[model samples]
Target chain A: MNAQQLCDRYAAGETEFVAAPLGGFNLAGADLIGINLTRADLHSASLMFAYLSRAKLAKANLSGAKLSGANLNQALLTGANLHNADLHGASLQGADLRSANITLATLLDANLIEADLRGTNLSGANLTGACLRGANLREEKRTYSSSLTGAILCNVDLQGANLKGADLPRANMSGANLREVNFRNADLSEANLSGADLSGAFLSEANLSGVNFAGALLTGAKMERVLMTEADLTKADLAGALLIDARMAKTQLAAANLTGVRLNRADLSRANLKNANLTEAEMIETYCARTDMTGVNLTNANLVRAELSTAILTWVEWRGATMPDGSEYRD
Target chain B: MSVQTSLGAIAQTFAQHNNALRLRKLIFCACTQRWESDRTRLEQQPWPQLLQDLYYRYPNPEALGDAIFGVVKQLNRQGEYSRLAQIILDQLTPLYGENATETTQFLTEQTQFFNEETQFFAPTAPHLDPDDPDTTTIITIAANLNAMEQNLRMRKLLWCLRHNSWENDPQALLRIDLATLIGDLQQEYPTREDFKQALGQVVGNLSRRREYEAIAASILEIINPLYHAMFSPDPNLGDALPPVVMVMEQTPAATTIQSLETEVHLQTAISPPDLSEFPALDFLKSDNPTTTEYDLKTSTNFTPAQPPPALQSPAVKLPDYDRYGVRLAVMKYANPLRAKILAFSILNHNFTTDSHEWSSLRTQPFDDLLRLLHEEYSTWDHLVEKLTATAAQLEAPAESTQAAEAIAKAMKPYYIPSR
Candidate 1:
């Protein structure tokens, strides 16, 4: 049926559009519940506010479609092309979006609770305030993205993404890719980011309290003034990174790479930096109270005006490094 | 002190312990409630500490069992003899040989009693029979029991090693013998060939040993049931899993080729003829090649204008007041009954907002709400006891149940199922 015919049917209380040939249709705000539009070409269609709950739209072409405020709960849209689609305020709870091409899609304020987005291309998408609680975003490329507060991005991709100002508090982003991402002002408290990649990321002033960055990468990253209280950056790479004025109270950066990094005025209170590298790094005016820098490398680095009270520097390499009191390195 | 006073003191101590438990519960409840109202506060809270603390406190076999028994006794009052009897028997298993035999016996007895007396607390419902072997719960319980048994056996093995009992067994010495054999084989072959031969011999020897077979069987039994669960047929499961990333590096030759094309196009357009009129280009028209080269070099040294500082830190903190206000407003309109149910559920499950467990609980099927509620009630009871004890220091009267109820009421609005 043509777009107008479908619209006529929908207006007659016919919510089901099974095997309907409404390709390239603009049926915005049409309630099409339980529609079977499998393999239909809805390319560039405007289905905003359309109720397509439990609809079978598998392999459908919805590229560049406007599906904002659409209710697609439990819908099957596997392998569908939703690239650059506007899905703001859409309800996709328990939807099957596996292998869908959702590149550059706008999913702001969308409800994706328990949606399966595995192998989906969410690159350059906007997911601000989206509910993706329990959504599987594994192996998806989500670069250049934004996911603000109320967005459940637990176990989501973020590797190589620019997530500046993203709110991911209480989200389980464990085992995600966050390499080279910018997370300034992001709230990632209670988020599970264990085994995530954060190499070369900028995380200034971000609230990362209770985040698990264990075995994560932070090499060459900028983390100035970050609140990382009780976060785990264990075995992370911070080589050549800037950590100026970073608050890392009770954080574990043990065995992390800090080679050539700047830590000027950074707070390392109760932090574990065991076996960390600090070669050619600056630690001027830094607080190292109760910090574990055991077996750290401080070669050719400056520690001018730095506090080391209750800091463990045992078995550390201090070759050619300068102390706060202008003393030459002895070890 | 009289027996009644002694009992009261014990109850008070239990209450104190409960208060501590409740504080932890409150933190988790607050997290969920806050998330529902305003997720921004999630950023301010310390989550990792909360998770670690929860992991350390709960699910510790020793602590959990003891705590459960203590709370159960404190909440229920009957003759002292029955309670003391229960305590003595419970403590005996660990004190005796640390064997599962006594513990298993006690657990079995309790399970039977609870199963039979369940109707006393609530109306009788159609029960699934374990002997029928057709029910899903029965199968699940059986699987759990099997896994638990295997875990207990492993624990025993570890315990034996710690106590140096392994040295007493000739068969246990096989591990050392195997190591020595591998070392000897390495010297003789000194290569993969030798390694393979040594491995073959070890495999042959292990195949002959009943212990090795038993160990292998136990491992398989424990893992087999989980195989289907891990690889469910649902397409959603496949979608939830992450994909692998591969980084491809471009070679210098390829990179140079790409840049060379762009540079050549630009160079041809800006030839010496086009610049001959300008004073700066006069050097390019000179017969001396060195002057032309110098002029070209000087022209290339044109610096671009310095851009504004894009990387500079923001001078002012972004106000999250609006988000907080929105959340508070939401809480105001929240349903109290739902909040109480949600709070109770959270408490029962030991849901700490800062914990991975709470997140996991949120993902559970809606059908399991009753189970979740039971867990929440158990947790709430503990929390109330703890709050009462802590409030004792304050001069003003404190009612822990009332506080808990209020919290529940505030949190109800955010407790709706995603479905």
Candidate 2:
């Protein structure tokens, strides 16, 4: 049926429509609530502003369709192919999109709150400014996709994804793979990144106050000038990482890997770095007063003009290391 | 004798000059050493208290800042002292002036002194208190050591938890979080050895707690169902019996007693009963029995089946019954096959299940029943395709026939006269 006929029928309480020769049909602004057009061939159709709430379009071919401003609340689109579809400003709240193909789809400004998107293919999708708050994107295989805070991608993939400036505060990204991702200037306060893979990630100037990075991998990562007051980086791997000028007051980096790392000019007052690997690390002019660096590795490391006055350094390896008073470790 | 008195006076003057320089050097050395050793104790004291003590001791900010800088310089040779130095500088800056430039310069020059005295400072040098025991000094030392031990224990606890360090010894970390062993170590340890022992205990405790938490989390999955069942109120007490028990109690018998008795009596009463008295024997007498049997066999053998129905037969008709009655019948039957097919067609064709074609059957309340049937059909059709396919595959032919018969019967009651 043509778009006008379909709209007329829909307005008359006839919600269902089996479009004939369905390619490129423009149904913009049509009200087709609770329609079941499953497995229909609607390729490249323009469904912009369509009311498709609670519709069942599972396994349907809607590739390259424009569904902007559509209402698809609680719709079931499992295994449906939505490749390259324009879904901007759409409401997909509570939709079941498991195993659906949404590759390269544009979902900008969409509301997908609490939707089940598990196992859905979202590779290369532009979900910028989309609201996916509490949406389950866990184990959903996505690649090179961009999901921002305006996107509410809390508890989403972010694992190994480049999420520079993504506002993920209180996001349940615990156990997510965030290795090598850029988080510069991101607000990650109270984000659950426990056991997440953030090895070598750049968090420079990021606000990580109260963020939980316990058991997270931060090896070789740069946290320079980052606000990490009260952050939990316990057992996090920070080997060879840079914390220069970073504020870690009351931050817990206990048993963390700081081997050959740089903490120069960083404020670590009252911070816990006990038994941490500081082997050959540069702590020049760093503020570690009252920090517990007991049993830390300081072998051949420089502490030039540093203030560790109250730092716990019992049994700390100071072999060949220089003290702040022009005294060698042995002396 | 006069010459001896003059020589004694010259010797005394030289001794006094020599003693003055020696005393100054001794004082300088003693001050530097005290500064180096006092830092550890000073850190443990409250910042305000420590600052007050430093100010009282030096009276002059410049001199106090210089002493602090001197200690900083000594540790700076190792390159690891820069952090601590900056802290000291920041803390002292509010109290002391930017006149720290001189002290900074002196530190740079003295950096080589640390390298030269490498062997003099023993690694095992007992961190001892001054001979003149002061309560403040003792308290500060104890606090510093305690903080250090606690910090170490915390580190070890985190390490064990993260690495799954107790995988082989699950109880190791569990005890730590439970017993707050780290906090305890901070209170109990005095020496490095004591600290080490406390740390070990803490680690073991932590491992134990970790194990407990993991096990508890896993056990939650198993307990959830039992917990729900125990707490939930039963709505249907009559249907509470298990399905298998119901089936066992209602099993049907293989044969009826009446049929068995009839067969036995017939077999015993007559050895091939008299044919003349039988009602069917009269008709047989008029015909040739041998030919009749032969003709009947020939007719059965000669009648070949008509060609099988077409794959897409339009004649596979929907009954012209009252839509509501047929729908109600379908619902009552709860036949999934018919419901699925009907729902599929309605959704695919964009037609209501209550349409003329479906409601023409003369069934009761055709309209409402059709709506209900349509809903039920739609609901079932919404399942995943794989599940639908499996359901279709498992359906028996007899069940399909039974469903078709029910629909036909429901439609029969609503037939309208063709105009």
Candidate 3:
């Protein structure tokens, strides 16, 4: 149907317009509030700056649609085919895009604040510089597993977002603000999270192996049992973080500030922690064999039962620190 | 002596006393952690290259052989079997014939020989040796004095004390020596007497027991002062021997040290044990602390192992909500805006002044209006009755009763059919 007919029907109080074929139509700056466009064919349609608040577009074909700078606040687009859609700088706040096929979509600079994207297929989507703060992308409800697998989320602010069980493997989230985000059981393996702020984030049971956390601020983050083998955490601020039972073999934590961090029962074998400040960190039962700890300050740190055999402790200051056998290593 | 003779003498000395504490210290100092990589490469070189490098760096054959033997022993201690075997092959092939079988046999025998030599030179417990208990205290004092004599400054001071005169010495040097000028250093330094007593006791023990070998070793420490004095720059010190040497010449200590040189010379004459055979020596000697020390170093210092996999926390599997069920559940809560719009149309088109439901709906809170609608209109028949009754009350004589019918037609499509 043409844009004129849709507008005329909407003026006549026709809110039910399911399965309407409105492909390639210029609906720019249109007010379609509270309209039902369920299963509608709006592919490649120009919905730029359109008022789509409270509109129902469930299972709609909006692939390749130009929705740039559109106001989609509180819109229900569940199971919609938004593949390759241009939603740049669009306001998707409080919009329910659950189970939507948004693969390869350009969500650059989009406002996704408080959006419910649970089980959304966001693979290969370029969400660079997007605001995903407080967005519920959690897969807590099992059937719809929300994932950003291989998505470019660089410079995105995801503070307080629920990303539980999300498949974010190999995602480039560098400089992203992930503060207070729930990353429980998320697969972040081989992902580039360099310079990301994950402070106070709950990352328990996350598969974080080979992840680049260089210069990232993980302060006060609960990273218990995180599998971080060969991960580069160089100069990262993990101060006051609880990393209990983390397997971080061959990980590069050089110059990282682990002050007051709890790494109890963690395996940090062959990790390069040169010049790292581990002052007062609790590392009971930690396995640190062959780890290059040159110039590390373990002042007042509890390393009780820690196996540091073969670890390069050259120039390491363990003054008054608790030894592996529960005895203080004085001076 | 010729270079060959000197090298032979050095090799003999090293092989005989390879396990001595003093030799161990020298070996460890030469093969420090800094030179470990260089040492590894050096072991891979051919026997001719190894010999030439050793001789060129340390012209003293005795010191060269000792250093090489130290390297070999250190490699063995470190459990570098491949490097050790390669080095032994390089050394043995040149000593024995170029026959592969003979060289292989000799290499195998050398391992056992070195182990036995290590055990033979091991220090015994103090209580195990009857003479050790009585001599240990004096030996310890003499050892401390020996250590002090090894100091470069102490060597310089001993030389100065022997050459410098109290009145003729420079004023600055004389002031420090002035204290010693009035009071002998023996009287000024408290430990001086202890050293002298220990030295005297060791000398006496050697002379009475006729243990010329022990005397030869003890007198080396005793003549250290004379050795330092020989290097003095005093013009008056001309061709004259140091005072301690002159004193030792008058005693049996000189003969003991002289006998060592003669004994080494005699051994050189005997066509030195044709190491070509390289007979396997018993290596089950239990007293060697070198092996134990090496074992402790490698095990405690840096045994690299993989981290255990049991540290990973069990992953929490989130509940996967069925999409259809989730959609159905979400539909249970009618949108408040839609419900309010429908309610407004109902109140505008059909409302009765006498109906209890209309009065109840007006009295109910705005937030509870949806609950009121759900509770008031449970069945279609009940909803129709209320609409028709309200329509009947609002109908004028000229107007048709079509307001209730219009309201039902407007809301029919929005309502979900009950199962």
**lDDT tens readout by residue for model 1, A3-91:** 77886776787665545555568787676788778877787888866778898898888888878657788999988888888775567
Chain B of candidate 1 vs. true chain B, TM:
0.16
Give a tens-digit lDDT track for model 1, residues B1-419: 33233334443443354343333333333223211111122223444444333223432233323433334343211123233323322322222222222233323332454466442221112343323322232233222322232233333232222232213221132112121222233345443322222222221121112222233223222222223333332222122233211111112111110112123211111111122132111111112111000000111111111211221232334322222122222222322112222333433433332355533443432213322332232223333443343334322223223434444333233232111
Q: Please estimate how well model 2 matches the true structure, expressed as its whole-model Cα lDDT.
A: 0.49
lDDT of each: 0.48, 0.49, 0.57
Candidate 2 structure quality by residue, lDDT tens digits, A18-103 = 43456798887677889877887889998876778898888889999988657788898988899999876577878988778887
Candidate 2 lDDT by residue in tens digits, B1-419: 23233334433442354342322222233243642111222233433333344444542223443455455454312123333333333333333222222233322222243336443221111222223223223322222222221222232343333332322211232122211222233335433223322222222232122222222222222122222222342222111222110000000111111112123211111122232232111111111111100010111111211211221233344333233234434433434223333333323332232366332321212233333333322122222222233333433334334444454444444332111
Which residue ranges in model 3 land beyond 4 Å of their true spot? Answer: A141-143, B1-419
lDDT per residue for candidate 3 within B282-370, as digits (tens), equals 11111211110001011111121111122123133323222212211211232211222234334444433235443343233222332
iRMS for all predictions?
16.4, 22.2, 17.8
In model 3 chain B, the worst 10-residue window by lDDT is B289-298
Interface RMSD of 1: 16.4
**TM-scores for all candidates?**
0.31, 0.31, 0.45
Model 3: per-residue Cα lDDT over A93-121, one tens digit each? 88999999999998875778889999999
- For candidate 1, give the lDDT: 0.48
Q: What is the TM-score of chain A in candidate 2?
A: 0.58
Best by TM-score: 3
